[model samples]
Target chain A: MRSDRQNRTPMGLKIAAAAGLAFLHLPLLLIFVYAFTTEDKSYQFPPPGLTLKWFAVTWNRPDVWDALTLSVKVASISTVVALVLGTLCAAAISQTRFFGREAISLLVILPIALPGIITGISLRSAFNLAEIPFSFWTIVLGHATFCVVVVYNNAVARFRRMSGSLIEASMDLGADGFQTFRHVILPNIGTALLAGGMLAFALSFDEVIVTTFTAGQQATLPIWMLEELVRPRQRPVTNVVAMVVVLVTFLPILAAYYLTRDGDQISGQGK
Target chain B: MPHAVTFQQVSRHFGAVRAVDAVDLEIAPGEFFAMLGPSGSGKTTCLRLIAGFEQPTSGHIEIFGETAEGVPPYRRHVNTVFQDYALFPHLNVADNVAYGLMIKGVGRAERAREAEAALEMVKLPGYGGRKPGQLSGGQRQRVALARALVNKPKVLLLDEPLGALDLKLREQMQEELKALQRALGITFVFVTHDQGEALSMADRVAVFNEGRIMQTGTPHEIYRRPQTRFVADFVGSSNVLSPDLTARLGGPRQWASLRPEDIRLDTDGHHRGRVIAASFLGSATRITLEIDGETLSVLLPSGSAVPEPGEEVAFSWSPGDLHVMGDEA
Candidate 1:
């Protein structure tokens, strides 16, 4: 009976699925093609020629190196901050009952739900009010605001899905609170945290608008790419950087997807 | 020796609802005790209290002569096999059984050796390398048992441990658990809603209802002489005779209980009733009869003449079979 249903997928649905895949992935393919293009001036179809010169050019640019380093630093720090804060917040909200718990959960996820421009403006004003200098820390702080939400969303879901009996069993088996967390709770939520951290890193890596308001004199990779687009200093170099960004960000998101895809099958669940 | 667990007027309340109300209980050391009740009858709550997962709202609890009210579950000398067999999914069976030893900083080699031996005792030897998810429900149950027993807790709390298995497997585990408890001489406090399981397994059984114990006694005593109407009905679904019916049955004018197996269908009996339903239960046929607007259930042994529903039948029990019960609601 299941095989009969599998064999009868409508042609229109198949076409629609193919179109959706093409629409999402074709631009990424274009970015890869242009990264190798000899045309450094503008977008050209089937470029007059493809060359490896752009790769060397991108590699030699010290400005590109600086921006790449700053972006990596901001993303790495923001992801770490998000991982700690998000997991803690998720554990608190999912495992306990208190007044305003629902409201607190909503507020924790509010930064990501709001527009990036709104978060950026509010953060900029807050930083100004506090008279804090906009250095590398400002960008890290800004990225962490939304990065935390991404992580919390992933973690809270996993925490809620986890059976509370596991914790009880741990304690009953002679584990203290910390020991139970280390042996039982940590193992159950470990993959979820890893996936959330990966997504947070990928989100912070390509963040543009929040970084724009928070960054005073810093040019993160995205801000650098935006500047190069407006002022025209080696277009293919920008495309090469974009290709690298895609690859770098794509790997983690892919990893995160794989990590959480079979998460429902955690052992001893529904038993 | 001190009692394995003692609750002196222990009560746990959640806002307006009383989950475990003013209940006193005593479980002896090395005794197989069962707390049997319907859901929400405080059996599981009392078990949790002994495990130190919950603190009483009032009154004191002691375990082995030690005050247990403020103590944490980790410090308590008891372990539980949860209904779902809460095994750690990430670890293999061996590591799971070794989790407590590891927490206590046992050497890895000894932990492995003991976990293997524990598995062997549970009849799951060499099943250690597999994850809990790979095993069937029965295998997971045994691993949970091994995991808890490996700790050698002074008191072992099993909360509906066999509730998740099939009927045949439940019976098998019940025997295995009883045998294991006997061999180890550990106090086994089992919580179950199954009367048969409690009856067949435990040395003493406490029947609970509405957050209070209706009665506590040996299975034979509880079955043969249930003191309250609730106990009589809950334990075996015996016919609870009203005061008027009790008076008519040659007993005092009080509530009484008559076991279904005690009544026999006799052609010359004085009592006559119309059969309402007849169910064939393998070795016996249970016939429900309406005698003077009062319902009476009678069990007939196999090969006896089976009466059709709506037919008039005569049934009678020995004068001693109708046991008078207390007037408590």
Candidate 2:
């Protein structure tokens, strides 16, 4: 009806949207193009020639494999810690009203709200003061500081949207506290936690600022990429690794978006 | 047998607000009891107290002769149909109905069979596979009812279950709920602000106001002989005649209630008034009149003559119809 006509976006707005998307993605397009370029040192327009040799070169590097292993381990461990701690914090804050609840919620999310360098420097100084050596565990702890915040943000929003009556209904239907949490609460928040965990993994995988401070002799993928850029060793190989990093991070983020877009579809809301 | 629920001067307070003030109540077993009131009138709080979602701040509560205080909701033999239905969004209809049985460690196949039976009882036999989101509002309401009833709780607490349905659906559900209660013979403690639902469905209705029960009686007794001004005014539209007007009408100088439908217009009528407005309501015409410095409403049958605005008319009711109300609480 008339709503279809009213919903038609203007040509100007459509052009603006397309231009905005292009502005953000065109640089990433360059990375894809250069990964196949034959040039080994400097970036060039249209790439003098396109070849697939960089992929094989990147695959052969032992250093690349080590960095990839470290990144996956750190991201996986950090995501696990974040999932447990973040869900606990979200459940406590969202389900109950107590003194200083708002302040506590703000403090939980403070690591992400502050500048990345600030979190990095504070974590480094704290570890040094405690006479602790920078190991893979240090990188995981640092990544977890912010990853927990990401998971907390997603979880708290979902918990607040969930109806309190659902819990009451479960309890009234003879479910104990543990049973209610397992059956009613877990299923309701399952997708949100999955999306949150994916986002946390993606964030920790590429996090370079804190990793630079916390990693002693270790090289995560991003730190390795940084070293490759500075030393200029088979430049297209770095681009090829960059292509992997983009895909590894992009798939989870895309999955998170799809998971959360239909978040308000909880059935029987306000019925 | 002991009553299904009993409240001995029970109250629930939150800081300075007494949400459910000290009040006593009793619900006989197998009775369809209704707690009717406007919002914040403590009807829902009372229902929650019975369901064990709420504990009384002071005083004792008993369920089937057992102590109710300090008992968790899961330990109580009661279930509730929440106002919003509260069907599990992640679960399909069959799983939602079988949630209680699942918690009790029922086997998968038996759970599915019982869930199907519960759905069939609610007249939704083949709807077990569909998700709650796919069903309409009324269908979700029935699913909520089925989910609660499948447990076979000693008492079923309903919190405004029909509040969200359209008029026709609400009326239909009300009859179905009444029939279900009668057939199951379980104590039903229903909470609602809709007086019509309470009047039409409950075996006994408790009218609540300001965290206290104004009156409790059979619907016919409540309609014909409201004991207080609040009950008379709230239960249905009635002309609450003050003591001054009662004296003018040759009744004792006491507060009285007169039903609109009880009065008849006739040439030999003694009481006279000027019609201020008249509105047609399909079956009857509601005539507002200015009588002795007070406004009174009278309902005339649709086929009867309606006096025009500003015209004089006389109406009278039988002496027995002029109900003298008791003193306020």
Candidate 3:
């Protein structure tokens, strides 16, 4: 009888969730519809005509490709750096007793918790103080600072849930330090690491505020879209590019969700 | 056989608490030794110290006659079956059991063969393809044992290996573990808080309290002749009476320990008492009697007629069954 009530609750929740999802996608659907409108100068409620010209125009633009490549490069490099540093920090903090561990953990998470504009301003000022020129590397560094928090949060939670006895058992079975980590700890946390890396990559790909401060003359995809919005002739192309960005970033987020879904249940029971 | 593992005055302190006080013990090769104690009594800590997970604050530990100081768990010729099993979740049964063999760089065919044999020994043949999550609690435990035993170490440490199983399964596994230990002829050092687990499985049991070993002996000896009050009370149900009650019968000790089964109920010429409570436990009826304001519990055979609560009764036992213990020692 109690389980019947539990079943009804999720059914109600599913309907509410479907409504919420429709609200979110309605605006996105309008954007896609307007991308094909022949009346391209202004974003009106209903299109006067429909044509494939905007996609053709978006495809021919070399500038869009340059921006897309730059965004990819920055996101890839930043995600790699975040994965390595974040994993090391998580591993060090998760399994040991030490002074200032809480403080260290807070510091690792603070970049993402703070406002994006604040992070951008601070990075800009710090770069100025160091007398470093703004370039691709500076943009990469800016993205990595915030991306590390995503990976670190996921990896640390994974590490904490992992049973310490597993490591002890591995060691007791005559596996050396590196071997134990390879055979036991790594396998246990593998799904979490993949999920974290994917989330970091998605976050870095779409980030615009910090990228604006860090990239002086170079334009990433988001920054390029901002430039195109301000400029007069490239309006429909901007909508097309925006749709592409959503797809590229959304796929990884979806993949990350699926990867991490089973991890929580497995770790909970394994403990 | 010579001592396979020994702890000489070993102690470990965590902040202000002494988790394992100065303790000395020797485990013979192929012997099934159990460290029995309540939670926080340092039985697990002793197992950890032997497994090289924790360094002693003082004293020395030796494995196979070699000093174990500074030796990490990986270097020690010992393996452990942790209470939660700790089977690798990502790996299937075969790979989990073969982990140790793979670490030693054994050939794939040999490792597979040995892992299968170990699985069969645990009565889980052809379960090699299933992950730990797919198996039941008991199956996971068997996989953990197979993983540990596949390494063929000199000593096997089990820290409450049956602790997570249900009572019936725990009893079944206890016998299987004992038989496996005999067949393998590996020294087994089992740690548990359950007296029945220790009494049924161990060749020798070491009773621990407050980070110190109170007594160590065979199960019969420990049960029949407990040297300390703590051991007598912890290992089995016992009737504790003030020394004044037994002074006329014997010594000057302040307390005397009597096993519940030792007390005989008779109709006359015995210590007269009133029945306070009677609990029928299927095999035996445990009767509590009030004598001179003190309650003494006695376990009588199921067929014995028990008096109603508040009825007069007489309790008597053989003089040899009384174990005198120093006050709270």
Candidate 4:
């Protein structure tokens, strides 16, 4: 029957899907395997033997500590900045009827849409023209451009989906403007903002290209990892650091996915 | 006494479209008033204006003797039960009901106690912990009621509050709403397009059409003597007789209306017509008759001798039953 055909997966298609998943995830599996490798100088196919010595070495290295701390600091600051800017932009764009509103929305998301090199070039030139020194703040500025887009996309979708009557009901029930927003509007979009903030943190943690232009001499974790890859040294340590990077960036994205999964639906609402 | 709410020459326009035209009206304190009209009739807009969600584009509004011009909804002493309930999705029933008090900075323990009492008021005492989504449509409606009533405002504006329920639930809610209004003694200004709801629930009904009130009166007065042709046809089903039919009924008027129940089918009667259709309603049967090429509806109670289609029937009515319209001095 047609139902039977739909219920069963063909052998060829099942194999193809398995192959695709393996192709995407196999590199991460190799990274984990090499992090425990006994060989310190070369990447032998089977990783020769396994040990935990590189983790101790990574913990003691001051350069790795500096890079890790800087990456965390930049990502956190950028996420905070993005949450405030993106939410305000989303509220203005979604809640009002004004001329050139679409243009404003397009402008908010343009930095993310443009190629990273183009964004880097523009930021570098703008900073140069303004005579601003590149430092931690400049690095944060570079990360926040795309971070704001992620937050804006999530926040605007939620703001647009939320029923306007909820705010009206709050007002009619004797809640002032600030109170209405805190009690009604904030609760409605809280999960969305959290998800957007998490995703932005993940993106900023792994960002490399924009940081390359904006950061003068400061080496973030990704930049340090790139340098380590170019000039090979204690190769197993680099693999161990990659494992940390994967975990650091992957946890927030995973949490963000779960947060936004059920956020699109309004409880007790028809649509 | 000053009215609970008053609109003086109010009008709200969205660009070229007049959502609420120049209007004047007053709602007395503790009165159950209904705005009855079809969609886009500006009844909802008028309710929103009272709620201060929308201000009059051109007139003045007053609440409790004070001119409420430019007053925000939060500053006004009025609450609303929206058609969709508009329950806060993030909070449980207790928190949702307590939102107004929380915004007003009421103590947590006191707010919780008041919320429970308010829930009990609407007959949903133990549903405080459940999410609004987990409850049924009727239960959610009660939660919305509890949320608005927790504040105890001077007037409660309901924008088609029972529109989302089934027929049986809607009927039950209508009775409960009327009882609640009487018990609380608060002004209840509800809007709806269902004439049955307006007639059975509200003390006074204002019929609206094309952004203007066609007539406003008590249910009996509006039903018995609808002033405008729109009020006659929209409020209830009526056989709007032409000027010719009006004259034949011994009425001096340009337009007249006759309720379907007023027409009687008897063997000995003044007028004769052919039965075109017979619809058997549970309590009453609506029989359509064609007299002189003009169709009329005659409603007869059940257990009467029913007329078959294509059968000839004689109908009669008292001259006083003819509601002559368009005879203003």
DockQ, model 2, C-alpha based: 0.78
Summarize candidate 1's per-residue lDDT along A17-89 as a digit string, tens digits.
9999999999989988988888777788998998999999989999999999999999999999998999899
Candidate 3: list runs displaced more than 4 Å. A1-23, A37-60, A263-271, B248-250
Which runs of model 1 end up more than 4 angstroms from their true locations? Answer: A1-24, A37-39, A44-50, A263-271
lDDT of 1 by residue, B1-329 (tens): 89998999999997888999999899999999999999999999999999988899998999999999999998888989999998998899999999888888899999999999999999999999999999999999999999998999999999999999999999998899999999999999999999999999999999999999988999999999999998999998999999988888778889999999999899988788899999999999999999788889999999999999999988788878888885653
Give the DockQ-based CAPRI class for model 2.
medium
Model 4: what TM-score for its first chain? 0.94
**CA lDDT, every model vs. true structure:** 0.90, 0.91, 0.88, 0.89
- Scored against the true structure, residue B163 in model 1 reaches a CA lDDT of 93
Positional deviation of A61 in candidate 1, in angstroms? 2.9
Rank by TM-score (best first): 1, 4, 3, 2
Checking candidate 4 for backbone clashes, the offending pairs are none
Residue-by-residue lDDT tens digits, candidate 3, A102-149: 999889988887878889999999999999999999999999998888
Q: What tens-digit string does per-residue lDDT give for candidate 2 at B25-63?
A: 999999999999999999999999998888899999999
Error of 2 at B149 (Å): 1.3
> Ten consecutive residues with minimal summed lDDT in candidate 3 chain B?
B245-254
Give me the candidate number with maximum TM-score.
Answer: 1
- Residue-wise C-alpha lDDT for candidate 4, range A1-271, written one tens digit per residue: 3787798999999999999999999999998999998887778889788899999999999999999999999999999999999999999999888999999999998888888888899999999999999999999999999999888888898998888788888888788888888878888888888888888888899888999999999999999999988666688888888999999988877787788786452111100
lDDT of 1 at A99: 93
* DockQ in order: 0.75, 0.78, 0.76, 0.75
True contacts kept of each: 0.82, 0.96, 0.93, 0.91
Q: Global CA lDDT of candidate 1, please? A: 0.90
* Clash pairs for candidate 3: none
TM-score of chain A of each: 0.91, 0.90, 0.89, 0.94
